[model samples]
Target: MDITAVNALPYEDFVNIFGNVVEKCPIITAAVWSRRPFVSLNALEAAISEFIDDLPESGKEGILRCHPDLAGRDLHSGTLTRESREEQARAGMDALSSGEASRMSRLNEEYKTRFGFPFVICARMNDKANILRQLTERCGNERAVERERGIEEVKKICRLRLQGLVLCDAPNKL
Candidate 1:
């Protein structure tokens, strides 16, 4: 949709269009809606980023918790959103060998146990092996540090999703 159409969309329509950008966090899209008439896709992104930056730690953790583990059960169980499934597949997550899958599952569990939240990365930006390596490395980070890193990863995922939703150069003329 064009930027003008985006700016004019009703709240429900806006949520339907962009809610999946942040997993199931419709609140993020809703908050961005309140700051509408985005001059460009960059403005829309800035609104979303500001909202995320201002969110309480609990809210940030809740958003992080909404994402599924990479190459994990959600992929096989059909629990992930279509966007997530496609992104994971693009990152070679769906083609992991049995051994690789098992290793990822273990690391996911370990990472969760250590950080109190699932490990998150912009899967579209990295292959499965690199994801696993980061998971292993991040598991050793201090809890607060890991939580902040997870939030940053979520921001990256959201930015990519928004790029898919918004026209990159269109001005909002509404």
Candidate 2:
């Protein structure tokens, strides 16, 4: 779809389509819709960034909490949302061996216990080995550092997702 179409979308329709760009945070999309007549994809992305950056500490944590753990129960039970499932699959998380799966579960639980939110990474940009490595390494980070890392990953995910919905470089975009 074109940026023009995206700009013209009804609030409900816009939310329905782009709602999960930030994992389960549709409210971001809803809020960003108010900044419409976006000049380009970059403008829309910047709007999302501004909203997220303005969030209080608790709100940032809330966004991280909305993400399902990678290769977690949701993935095994087929309960992940379509976008999440596909992203996890891209990281080969959908086919983890029993040992690998169990290890992931244990580490995920540990990470959540420490951080009050699940570990999150741009799975589309990483394979299982890299994700596992990141999960372990990030667990050692300070709370503030980790929170910013997770939020940055969320932004990367959102950028890719938005790229899929609207033309990235279309001129005269609404």
Best by lDDT: 2
Model 1: pairs clashing at backbone N, Cα or C within 3 Å: none
Write down the lDDT of every candidate, Cα atoms only.
0.86, 0.91
Candidate 2 structure quality by residue, lDDT tens digits, 1-174 = 777788899999999989999988999999999999898788999999999999999999999999999998898799998999999998999899999898898899989999999899999999999998888898889889999999999999999888866655663443
Off by over 4 Å in 2: 168-174
- lDDT score for candidate 2 against the true structure: 0.91
| Candidate 1, residue 30: lDDT | 89
lDDT at 93 for candidate 2? 97
Worst 10-residue stretch by lDDT in candidate 2? Answer: 165-174
Report residue 133 deviation for candidate 1 (angstroms): 0.9
Q: Where does model 1 exceed 4 Å of error?
A: 168-174
Model 1, backbone clash pairs (residues 3+ apart or across chains), number: 0
Let me know the TM-score candidate 2 reaches against the reference structure.
0.94
